[model samples]
Target: MCNLYTSLYVAISVSQHISVYSIGLGPTELLLLTLLAIILFAPRKLPELAKALKESADIIRREASGSAEKSSVEDKERALKEVAEKLEASEKQEKKKRRFF
Candidate 1:
């Protein structure tokens, strides 16, 4: 009974160590999902499905990159406007100083 208990404890510990919490699929899971996809979808339709997925990924990437570029351009424009405003203010200060002198 002691030996049986030790074996059970070892097995439970090993299983617990092997278990993982993850949001992403491992290779075996991915392979099974691929097999399931093959069984459910037609061979002729696979290419079209793959193409649609690629297009969607590309569109998402483009939108993300475009937003980054847009923000950068906006930052540059804001900085330029600030500098122009400061320049105008300094020019006005210089003109007032000239009038007093």
Candidate 2:
């Protein structure tokens, strides 16, 4: 049980550190890490642990991408609104000019 937790912690920490620091580990390092995980944990546990981690990662990725898309849409809407407001102001100015003439 302790070994499982320790290995999982190490895996999560390594993943976070890699992403945060942009550490580039090649295929050999990844293979070694996978083998180390297998050595640390039961073979049967690996699939289940990998599945859980994959699901968690997917959820986080979807959420981040979704929020980014949402913000971009909001920015587009804001820009459109600003353009509309400027057009309306210009129309008012045109009307004022017509009334003056």
Candidate 3:
């Protein structure tokens, strides 16, 4: 139920033209959360946490894009294979017809 709600929330935010999401928070909300974090953590600690978050987000983005590219390439290869098989079958049929005549 919460997962569905998060998905819907992100979808709505995207349609409304917000381009950034930070761990389920919109920009304004994220700012508020950051303030709260500052109150809770040391200034030095905040930079370390931010660096780790940025690295993880980068890794996730890279993997997601890589998988999407791989899937598209695989789809194109499969389509070409199917077309080749179809052409080969058609050629075989034509050869059989020619042989009979």
Per-candidate TM equals 0.64, 0.72, 0.73
Score candidate 2 by lDDT.
Answer: 0.72
List, residue by residue over 69-100, the lDDT tens digit for candidate 2: 99999999999999999999999999999999
Q: Please tell me which model should have the higher lDDT, number 1 or number 3.
A: 3
Candidate 3: C-alpha lDDT: 0.65
Please report how far candidate 1 places residue 4 from its true position, in Å. 48
Whichever of 2 and 3 has more TM-score, that candidate is: 3
Rank by lDDT, highest first.
2, 3, 1
The residue-by-residue lDDT of candidate 3 on 1-101, one tens digit each, is: 45444433443433234235534656677556566655676665665555565666678778989999999999999999999999999999999999999
Stretches of model 3 off by over 4 angstroms after superposition? 1-24
Instruction: Provide C-alpha RMSD values for all models, in order.
Output: 14.0, 6.8, 10.6
- TM-score of candidate 1 to 2 decimals: 0.64
Off by over 4 Å in 1: 1-32
- Residue range with the least summed lDDT across 10 consecutive positions in model 1: 14-23
Q: Clash pairs of candidate 1? A: none
lDDT of 1 at 59: 82
